[model samples]
Target: MTKIIFKEHDGKEHPVDVENGMTVMEAAIKNMIPGIDADCGGACACATCHVYVDPAWVDKVGKPESMEEDMLDFAFDVRENSRLSCQIKVTDALDGLIVTTPEKQF
Candidate 1:
């Protein structure tokens, strides 16, 4: 399992142990991390699970794929660090990944 830190808009943080290969959104939902609406259930068809990858971990987490980038066009307050949690798969290299939710999902 990989450990991921999810920070809510209000600055609350939730640390979760997620199985390898599972999408970050799945872990958030399972752990009841607030701010991850996951309206499309990790389908990459919606942006409700939008998050800002911690700048320090951006290189490790990598950028969003084209499909995710397209969907992110609909997210709120998108920035250089913006990403759809559903598109980020867990891996041993990603242990201790950190992501922060937007003030609201779109």
Candidate 2:
């Protein structure tokens, strides 16, 4: 399993072990990590699951695709490291991935 760390805007952190191939949003919901609503599931249909991937892990996590980028336009406080958690797939390479959620999902 891969371990992913979800950090809330308020500095709270939730660490979870997730199987490979699962999306970050899935891990968050399954582990009850607050702040990631994932209103559209993992379909990348909404920006409710927006997160800011830690700079250190950005390369491993990679950039979002065009579709995801478009959806991210609706996320709050978007930055260079901003991404839709649902667009990030968990993998062994992402074992220690860290992502921070926005103050509000909308």
Number of backbone-clashing residue pairs for each candidate, in the order shown:
0, 0
C-alpha lDDT (0 to 100) for residue 77 of candidate 2: 91
Scored by CA lDDT, what does every candidate get? Answer: 0.94, 0.92
Candidate 1 structure quality by residue, lDDT tens digits, 1-106: 8999999988889999999999999999999999999998999999999999999999998987889899999999999999999999899999999999999996
TM for candidate 2 is 0.97
**TM-scores of the models, in the given order?**
0.97, 0.97
* C-alpha-based local distance difference test score of model 1: 0.94
**Residue 13 C-alpha lDDT in model 2:** 86
Task: Tell me how far candidate 2 lies from the true structure as C-alpha RMSD in angstroms.
Answer: 0.7
How does model 1 score by TM-score?
Answer: 0.97
User: What's the lDDT for residue 56 in model 2?
Assistant: 99
Tell me the lDDT of model 2 at 101: 92
Off by over 4 Å in 1: none
Clashing pairs in 2: none
